[model samples]
Target chain A: MDLKVEHEMHKRRFSRNAGLGFVLVGLVVLVFGITIVKVRMIGNVPEAYNAAAGLPTAEAGE
Target chain B: MSDMSADKSITSGFENEAGFSDYYALLKPRVMSLVVFTAFVGLMVAPVPVHPFLAFVSILFIALGGGASGALNMWYDHDIDAKMKRTMNRPIPAGKVTKEEAFGLGCALSGISCILLALTANIFAGLFLAFTIFFYVVIYTMWLKRLTPQNIVIGGAAGAFPPMIGWAVATGGVSIESVLMFMITFMWTPPHFWSLALFTKTDYADADVPMLTVTHGREATRKHIFAYTLPLAVVTLGIAATSIGGWSYLIVSIILNALFIRGGWQILRRDDAAAEADDYKAERSYFKLSLLYLFLHFSALLLEAALKSFGWGGF
Candidate 1:
């Protein structure tokens, strides 16, 4: 009975720590995903802005 | 009977043996994430465009610099970490990694990041990176952490520098936008961190670290939290109004600041007994919320910049 209780407590502790780890990893992924998406999306805007300003787009070939 | 008990103890202890994951915990990846995001925002908002290759290099160096600071912070605080329940499981105290290893990793990464920044970007950005490492490792970790309750208030400047470094990487010089980015972070650090300190007073006190809660008492810390938070909200909104940010950012800023102020006000109203009774759950939740608040605010700025470039609403 004592052995079983000890094992159960250990399992609980492990699960708790693992849960915290998952939460942290989730937060990191959320921030990283947002950053990458925003960067890629915004990255092309400068070119579009230039094009709209009547300047030849850099990739449009001279 | 005795032999059986001994075997049981040994096996149980082995089961709890910590490893690399524990060491990684000491690096404070969540804080590092904010540093990287804000730095990326600064890089994106700069007037000059950096080559994609160079931008990648700059962000990489900034992240490494952040990790180096974390490792060094753990190395210096290992003694206290052992005492604090919150930090007692950290690698050094838990015997997962040696202090020497952490120190070596910190030193190696710091040197590599600084030199790489100089090579890939400009000397100005590299210099800022080196100064940030020095400030966090030497000034904050070695000196201020043990010496004063105000350690984080000043030490927080180290984390605030990444955006400036990112800006420098792009423009090769500092400008008002970079300064505004720095100001937003500089003001935000005190309230965000001190709230955690307020809730974790026992751990800090046990560790012999003079956090505000330990030095000034919970009531005083609560007052200070609200005080710093008011200015922080103002700075956050102020940054949104600048040329680097636009309407989407301003709207996000206003909403986030209102929520942050409400949280801070809630913290101020709670007494030490009430805070302790809830296991500091309120403060902990608020701290978590603050992290998301800053991330969203910066992300909004990036969104606004994108909107402007597409000939949409620039204001």
Candidate 2:
């Protein structure tokens, strides 16, 4: 015989907690997307730096 | 007596337990929409291109920054808000959210939005967002609102910063086009707000906030509104000559400015006695027009930018 009952406070707070959860999750997704874009757009590195780092460059590779 | 006490306790309990909507109300979402739209236009019209995702993030952060400032403003102005009929039902005054919660939320979001915006866009965009929040919270809300009749004039600069910040997010700096966009909003705020002040009657005076209508006489406020429309029209039209402005913007500006100038003229021509007799119909309609006026102008600029993307947008 389970006698567990939800408290009134818990019911009232559910919406706020859910909203905060959604916002946090959305923020995480946005940060992940930004990270991916930033990593992929690293081609702006100067030719000299790329050469020094032993990375291929358009001018040098040709 | 027992029943009355029970009812009071129940109501108090409900009020004390704020829902998510009450928290959202603190952000003044209506104002945030304007911030978001203008900021989007600023980003789109810039000569430089931004990645679609980055642009979305920049606008989101800018809106967050605007909302954070709004929360801070509500926290500080809760006292005045409680007094005014227009604001008495806000989250704070209505006893839904506490002042400390609002302050904490505002500060946290402000810092996070500014820092993340800088990381996502550029240092200039981040710093500009911070400055805009500071200007709205500190300069406009705390310092000038209660102290001066020119409150809207100076405070308008805070609202006008969004487009400039958007431009910075794209180009990482300002330009004539962005400056012109900022000026359009800046010059338009006085007439837009003063017209509202005219119809709302004693909202400002009742709150003890020194709006132009409170400090200056009603006739003076009217004259100022009309006087402002001239310069507002100039700034609105001036943007059409810039790089981002095009045939669409030019036609929109001409028609809107003509209607705006006519609206201002109608407002200026009416006396208070006549206005009150007609239930402030002229003033009320003028305020309504101001809303459409701003929306259309920005929409036209956005349209021009969209066209230019396909190699047909600008002159």
Best by lDDT: 2
The per-residue C-alpha lDDT of model 1 at residue B37 equals 87
lDDT scores in order: 0.80, 0.91
**Candidate 2 residue-pair clash tally:** 2
Query: Residue by residue across B46-144, what tens digits does model 2's lDDT show?
Result: 989999999999999999999999999999999999998889999999888999999999999999999999999999999999999999999999999
Question: Which 10-residue window in model 2 chain B sums to the lowest lDDT?
Answer: B6-15
Model 2 DockQ class: acceptable
Which candidate has the highest TM-score of all? 2
Write down the C-alpha DockQ for each prediction. 0.05, 0.40
Q: Write the per-residue lDDT of candidate 1 for residues B1-315, one digit (tens) a residue.
A: 676586577566555454446656656788788778888888887878877756876797788788888988888888988998877877888886778889887888789778877866789998899899899888888888888999878777878888898889898888877887888778788888888777653677666778887788779988988898898887888876677877788888888889888899999999979987989887988899888887897788788767867876446
The residue pairs in collision within model 1 are none
